[model samples]
Target: MHVVVVTKNTPDTAATVTVKGDGTIDWGDSLVVNPWDEYAITEAVLLKEAHSGKATVLTVGTDEHQEALKHGLAIGCDQAIRVWDGALDGCDSLGYAEAVAAAIRKLGDVDLVIFGRELADIATDQHVYQVARKLGWTMLGYVAKIQALDVAARSITVNRLTEYGTQTVRSTLPAVISVVKDINEPKYPTFIGIRKAAKAEIPVWSAADLGLDAAALQPRTQQLRYQELPKREGTVEIIEGATAQEKAAKLIDRLIEEKVL
Candidate 1:
């Protein structure tokens, strides 16, 4: 089985996000793997070991994306692919899905593809579906547990967590799965693994390398503006009455008048 895990470079959740007056973000060189992708990485590593398969990390970004790729390698991925196409700038979810799907197709004979339930930066949670659509593969999303995966049989079964309840899904191999954070606990890379990953040669690719059309990579959406959230203000008031009944009556009236009842 060959497993591919998709990851993305994003600001550390702990990092302070600041928007400049000119509407540009000041990242200040702090970057890390999207927190949610950690689950996908862990799942890929576990699945690879269980099935004696190969696991690879795939990412799309600039030079700063190396950190995220290395982190995945340190965790247990066999190799990494970084797509740094200049034409991918400002690429939205659809564009990203296109590039990643193209790369996967280039890899050839892949059995499984994994992704985080959502990207932390955008939080749109659309990459998995988009990539699956592009590849014409079965996509199981919000997977909380991979109950079964049979590479030889070319089949898989998983329990997905939905808003209403958990749903069990069965699909064939060559599928795309988006795992939620509850799927598994991510393991921290050991010192030895970290050192090895740091030295690993992560090949970078461009749109041409993936046989992708630059025109198709153009983003469909545009940002209109960026505005800081307004600061919250608080005020406190105590309901007053001489007696319990009086207080109750006053509170009822106030709630009724405010339409909060």
Candidate 2:
């Protein structure tokens, strides 16, 4: 299958992510793989098992992103690759699409590219469509299940979730697909796998390696500014009464006095 899955390191779902007073995001020390990408990695591994092919996971970021690649390696990906450059700072979805599309092209023989529905950190999924567009490949988003794969015919049939309902459609191979967590339960990395991934050497590709220049890394979309809203303050009151009826009466009276009744 030679499936290539994209993943990212993001704040842990349970972490309290907030914008600091300096305008930078504070994710604390807890970071993990994008929760949605778990299913994507699992799907890649499953595809490799079913088709006796390789599953390679790729990402774009700094050294901090290696954690995500290691997780993919532990999850059964045959290889892990990362791309980044100083110039890529402040890069938006369009710039990422440029880098990712170029990297995929450099690989030359990727049959399928998969992704999580969205990135947890960015809370946006535009890169998925942008990457597909840059590659001029068919994009199947919100895939619930991969129904069939015909390597001989170079076709794939998948059941994808639509706003209307689940719809099954077939498309040619060498395409892009975005999956949801419901597609499959991701397997936890085993002790052996974790140790191996910890030792695995992941190659980092630079913008030049992907034939990208500083101009390409420039963000097409800009975020002018953002400010956190002040926290609203409130107080809690305990209503006390000797009986339920008394309590109800008091609650009603309070509500009427507060003009909320």
Candidate 3:
């Protein structure tokens, strides 16, 4: 049971968003691990413990993202791999998926690949399917529960959540799975784990290292600018009436006056 979890570093959700002069979100000093990826890492750790196998964490980002990878390693991954290059900036979902797939191929002999259902910042739920398509591997998305792993049968049974309800699915091993937030609770890294992770040397890979062509993985989407959201306004109004009906009438009148009706 060799499990690989893909993770990404994203802007902190709590940080105040800023717009740069060029009109792009200013990530001056904001970064955090994508929340959904945390679940994938935790699940990988659990699977490794249960099945007695190695769990490796991988990420595609700049050197700044090493902190995020370290966090994953601290949570229990046996090792971490990071693919960093300036060209990775502004990579669209398709390009990212291609890069990840290429990296996975380089590793070889991997039985399972897991990913967060979607990245928090981009909110793109395309990577899982894209990677699966590129690798010609089985893909199970929005998995809420992993029921069983039948090594002998070379398949895994899982429950996927949908708008209507949940459906049970059985997919062959060496598959890719995208887990929703409701799948499981993520674990925090312990002090000992953090220390070990801090000292761990994360291997870095580039496009060439993964046998990827820069032109093939070029980004399609271009960010024109970043802008801050408009500030909210607060207004209050009061109306006095002699009866309930009069009060209702007054409210309606106010609504009409404010063009809210």
Which portions of model 2 show Cα errors greater than 4 Å?
A: 224-226, 229-261
Top TM-score: which candidate number? Answer: 1
1-261, model 2: which lDDT tens digit per residue?
689999989988887666777777666868799999999999999999899999999998988889989999997999999998887889999899999999999999899999999998779999999999999999999999999988778999999999999999999988999999779989889999999999999999998888897887788788764467777777767889999999999999999999998
Per-candidate local distance difference test:
0.90, 0.91, 0.87
Q: What CA root-mean-square deviation does each model show from the true structure?
A: 2.9, 3.4, 3.3
Name the lDDT of candidate 3.
Answer: 0.87
Steric clashes per prediction: 0, 0, 5
TM-score of each: 0.90, 0.87, 0.86
Candidate 3 per-residue lDDT over residues 1-261, each given as its tens digit: 789999988888888776767776667567888988989999999998998988989998887788778988999999899987666667887788888998889889788999998888877788779999999999999998999987668899999998889999998998999998887899999999999999999999988788777786788777665556676777666778899999999999889998989
Worst 10 residues of 2 by lDDT: 223-232
C-alpha lDDT (0 to 100) for residue 53 of candidate 1: 92
Alpha carbon lDDT at 214, candidate 2: 82
Predicted candidate 3, C-alpha RMSD:
3.3
Question: Which clashing pairs does model 1 show?
Answer: none
